[model samples]
Target: MAKQTPMMQQYLEIKAQYEDAFLFFRLGDFYELFFEDAKKAAHELEITLTSRGGTHDRIPMCGVPYHSVDQYIQQLIEKGYKIAICEQVEDPKEAKGVVKREVVKLITPGTVMEANLLNDKENNYLATVADFEDGSFGFGRTDLSTGESAVTLIEGDLNDVIYELASISAKEVVVSEAFASKYEDTLEQQLNLTVSVEEERELPESMEGLCSELEQSKLIETMAPLFHYLIKTQKRSLDHLQKVTYYSRNEYLKIDYHSKRNLELTETIREKKKQGSLYSILDKTETSMGARLLKKWLEQPLVDRKKITERHSVVQSLLDNFFIREELKDKLKEVYDLERLAGKVAYGNVNARELVMLRRSLHQAPSIRIM
Candidate 1:
């Protein structure tokens, strides 16, 4: 019937493990998809979704050259899909059976590292909860999307976590066993999260409120036996929440949609910076988050124009003024505050990069002293 390549068997196995994610099966020169994955990939990728060696009928097939897989992967992830990048760990030319294929990386909407999938101006948040007693131990949140983050130590009863989760709006979450038990009851309640109780850290039942948080956050990973899911929610009512002083309004400033109408429109940037062709830009090299940020910035430069200009000038000055790019880069590396960087970039502080472009503006060539 059909030629069942050894790789196909391995693909099936890996697919079983990651039902939520599409398997980007890596072969010699192409990354292929089979069965329904093929149909889906074909429609989404808009490329030829053909089939491989025909069987009793035909095995569905769709593929992209290994070199071009990045673009395809970026698209799938942006579509809110999880992608299990199954790569060939062994040399396909020499391997005997199915040329070993194992998932090298799993790119979910919440945890993606591709430069093409991130924004330099916004945060990609991942939240975690630890409820020891009443399902309100609060949460620890980080968003590397824009390389900036925000976290709130929740108070109140069990429902407080829900409000906090809604406020923070993180994409993924990890819960402790003690906290999961606190997840809220009321089956009719829906907040949007993947909740999984930890088996090893099992705590008493007082923290049942945390269960809602777990369910909404999708408890992406478990320390013992965790659960995971995609977070999708829009309803927000910040009730029974207290504010912490460690935060400044600068961190919470909003960029109006009308203002962000032209920061770095992906298509425009690509066209203008395409070097030879009008269809090219450095965007292909940027992560999805970064792309979104650039687009957002392009759409609303005035939101924080002053800071944005600063970062812009910094980078431009460096490229135009110095030759010590590497040494200056080391200095920029000293900056530990991504949120601060994001603020500067959002406000058009493009010159911030100048501080590290060619040399350290801070260290300088030794200031001359007057006699």
Candidate 2:
């Protein structure tokens, strides 16, 4: 290997830290990708593949303007690429050598919080499966967009996990190191999941005597590795994360793939799209969160007649008052997606426009109270 320039040396150092991700090395106004990253990105994005400073051995390179980089990121993520955004940490105007740059955030398809890159009506989930010695699977899933987290124990084989995950439609999955090594091919071939491996580790010793017996039992060994990976990559306190929802496999009605397809509950079997489906036809939601919650209700319909009647009573009350129902619907239209907005705020990514939207949504609360 030839000696690297000071700037290139800095790039290499940062690049070494995030080998799995495509490094978006910030240089002045452009985010540059060197060598293999450049080659792959150029090929995938169909952008100009060029080179940088070497007379005899030029390095492969590609770049996009920082202002227009989000679209490129969206494209890369759609192609199942993780991106490490290296930003200029120190101002170049006062830099002694090359302006110091660091990876600010790592963006993956499952962890994206950008409104433009995400579907408003759908939850983006990252799921994890841990194989147990007893042949059961400990499953964990979280939607970083909505801060919803759930875990369950599936008392069957990998096929059971695959079936559940397919229904959830998760963008990514993580598994224990042992599980990944053993079933990597099976998971990939069967579900076509972007599976990542995490080391198996015990929960912190300090928390051993901290909680009730129920909470302690709910703290499964599998959850630690997945949550650790998320914390490391996210590099922030996931304050928005909800309580770990431990559930039994039999809590909800089990709808198989064929049944979902035949019933056309959410998507048509032919087009595999939501248009003309039951959800689309019955979806009278005003906000993104409402749409998502409605979909969830449809997917997991309650079997308990008492709970069902409670929901029906609310609907019956509204149905009885036509004027009030009309007024409530109009008021709901004024509100925005509070759930996702709150998630973005907790993630420290909410902007001025989003704040204004939040205020507008809150303003509708008073009118809604009239119901």
Candidate 3:
């Protein structure tokens, strides 16, 4: 017989729903994992690998304490893992038989909104793509913490959205229920984006002829499952995405991938990002994760600008010039949150850390006052 704990049963139920992402089964003091997730996290995070005493051998198990979750989260995130934090919604002592555990948060390299898990000048983004209107679809997204919104209308090109999303690497999708099947199939075929669900009653439904056309999009059969990040952005894309071309006021920072590595945007200015201290002003109060992510993105923009810019000339004069790149890469998991940080800074919700990072990056190239 399969040994069953109330907790295990609950876990299985949630896992069935969130099949694509790792479930952090929250117990009293630790965030637990079961089966394959347990084995993977145990090996990767160096946690104590244990097991559930089941009749047929045993079920895999592993976990990290709530206190040290931040560090462990960093390791998993760095390895491109997505963790769904399932926590006890009520005190076990006051609960019936088993405690109520719910997914308090889903942590992906992108869309992180926690403190102690984020940095300054960084942004975390989650985007939604949809197929709508006569074989044509649109894409839309918003950085909740930074108020950065995006709407791009893609025409007749499903893969175009996928390619664009891949270029930007949107971390999650608020999918529509109607086109779930085709969206899943297409995303798998075209972009290799996995799927997951968040029961947000707030997600908008798609209208128009998008339903049938998208459900009928051609499917390809020979692509490999390209697993980059653990938390899935979409099983398929959700309903219809918003307009696809306009840039949000506070959008994901862009410098082209080339600029992020060799050239340092913050070489001209160097300051550490701290929370609630002198750096508090720049701390993304809306979401610190975005702040930290933005900081790194600014240091290492993803672009192909000229090698010798005036700002590069200034940064090249420093001794700890390499810190610019180090900090950038060290914080590269989800620079999506850069938009949130930008918004905060733009609205004067920041400090020296924000100013320094922005000044250095802006110095390198031409002024970027988006219309």
> Which candidate has the highest lDDT of all?
2
Which candidate should be chosen as best, given TM-score against the real structure?
Answer: 2
Q: 202-254 in candidate 1: lDDT tens per residue?
A: 42232233233343232212211211221212011211111111222243344
TM-score leaderboard ranking: 2, 3, 1
lDDT on C-alpha atoms for all candidate structures: 0.51, 0.81, 0.52
Q: TM-scores across all candidates?
A: 0.50, 0.92, 0.51
Candidate 3, lDDT over the whole model:
0.52
Model 1 ranges with Cα > 4 A deviation? 1-5, 129-137, 144-151, 156-169, 175-371
Tens digits of per-residue lDDT for model 3, 1-371: 46567777898988886666688888778788899888888889877889867466788899878998888888777555677778788977799888887776666655554434554444445566555446655565545345544455566455566655555445555455554555766654454443433333222333222222222221100000111111233222222222223532123344443443234333222332233233344433333454555554444343435533544765565335676545444444323334444554543444676566556555532322220
TM-score result, candidate 2: 0.92
What lDDT is reached at residue 229 by model 1? 24
> Model 2: per-residue lDDT, tens digit, 89-163?
987989998888888888887788889999999988888887766777778788888887777888887778888
In model 2, the worst 10-residue window by lDDT is: 205-214
